[model samples]
Target: MKLYSYFRSSSAYRVRIALNHKQIPYEYIPVHLLKDGGEQKTSAYGKINSKHEVPVLEDKNVRLSQSVAIFLYLDRANLNNPLFPKAFPDFEKCFELVELINSGIQPLQNLAVLKKLKKDFEINDEQKVQWIKDIIRNGLLAYSKKISDEGPYSMGTELTAADMFLIPQLYNAHRYEIDFTGLEKLLQIERTCLMLDSFKTAHPDIQPDSV
Candidate 1:
């Protein structure tokens, strides 16, 4: 198995944490997203992933894009550590958290979207930063209200894939200097998750391609 990743990408960071937590071994291929006018946009990478995004997992003959799909595949393929309950409401609940971050927060403020805002609508740095801050704050606020308080993890005693999603989004939140004065629950979760080896090794600061 192989993972194509870009350091500082929140989406890729989630997958890294999941892979480490599951103790799955895979070769790391760093795809420099910003180097040489964006490496992901190159003709070469396009052949591998038409979307030109990171967190693309290649195992045997199956190549997958999108972090949620890759994570679900990883969980099913390696059944020892399940990320969520297999039953009805419990399973559905986990996906709700995943989509909260995956769709609600991540897509609106990712690199491509930010650049598009600048290029197409001509938004300036101040506007772009504010845009990011608003999305992070709103999404995190909703998450803080929805999650179980019994946790160091979002879903309670077990560290589900929600933590995998939350940690990276928190990293980005801190990266952009988003204020967390009212988000105490999220702060506690971040503090608790960093104590784990999985999240620590998966952090952007420790990645080989970090610069």
Candidate 2:
């Protein structure tokens, strides 16, 4: 198995965490997203993932895209350590949390989107930074409320894939200097992730290609 990844990409970071948590061994194939005008846009990577996205997981002949889907595939296929909820409502809530981060938050302020904002709309760095801050505040404000009533994890203290989703988004939040403030539940969840070897080892700075 192999994973086509960019070291600093939050989406790729989620997949790396899942792979580490499962103790699944795979070759890391670094895909430079920002070198020589974006290698992810090159024909080589485009063939693997037509969307030209990072963190494309290849297991044998099957290729997977979308960070959440890849994590689900790994967890479901290998039950030694499931990253999903066993209960129906809990599972639903987990998916809900994933949606909050992956769909509601990540897409709006991703690097590609920010690049587009600057190139097409002439948005300055300050404006771009503020836009990311707004998204983080709006998104986490709602997530903080929903998860606060739960356990240490996003849905609870079980370390589901939702936790994988939360940490990276929080890391992105920190990049914008947005204070987490009174989001105690989220803070607790973040602390839990920090204590885990999976998340710690998979962090961007420790990655083999990290620059």
Candidate 3:
């Protein structure tokens, strides 16, 4: 298996956490997102994923892109530690949280989007930071409210896909200095998630590609 990844990419980070959680071994192929005008845009990588994105997982005959889809694929393939909770409400709730982070929040604050905002609108660095902070703040506040108070993990006792998604977004939150002022529940979950070996090993700073 080969994982085309960038060290600081939150989407890639989510997939890495899931892979580590599942105890799957794969070769990490670093695609430097910012060096030489983004290596992902190169023709060589285009052959792998025409969309030109990181977190492309190539295993046997299956080649997958998009972190959410890749995560679900991995979870389905390895059933030992299920990414989704086994019950009714918790299972649905896990999906809800995953959608919140994966769809609602992550896309708006992605590197490409941020770069586009600057390139297209002439948004300065300070303004870009403010933009990211505003979006993350509103999204996280809503997420904090939705998360149950019973959690050391997002969906309660078991660590689910929602936790995998949340931790990386929190890493982004800290990276861009997004104000996590009143998000106690979210912060608590993040703290707990980081203590685990899976999350620790998947952190961006410790990755081989991180500079």
* Top candidate when judged by TM-score against the true structure: 1
Overall lDDT per candidate, in order of appearance: 0.91, 0.86, 0.89
lDDT of 2 by residue, 58-147 (tens): 998789999988977897778877877889888888889889999999999987899999999999989999999999888998888778
lDDT assessment of candidate 2: 0.86
Q: Which candidate comes out best when scored by lDDT?
A: 1
What C-alpha lDDT does candidate 1 achieve relative to the native structure? 0.91
Candidate 2 off by > 4 Å: 148-150
> How do all the candidates rank in terms of lDDT, highest first?
1, 3, 2
Query: Which 10 consecutive residues of model 3 have the lowest summed lDDT?
Result: 148-157
In candidate 1 the C-alpha lDDT for residue 17 amounts to 90
Model 1 is weakest, by summed lDDT over 10 consecutive residues, at 80-89
Alpha carbon lDDT at 29, candidate 2: 93
Q: Candidate 2, residue 121: CA error in Å?
A: 1.2
- Which order, best to worst by TM-score? 1, 3, 2
User: How large an RMSD does model 3 have?
Assistant: 1.1
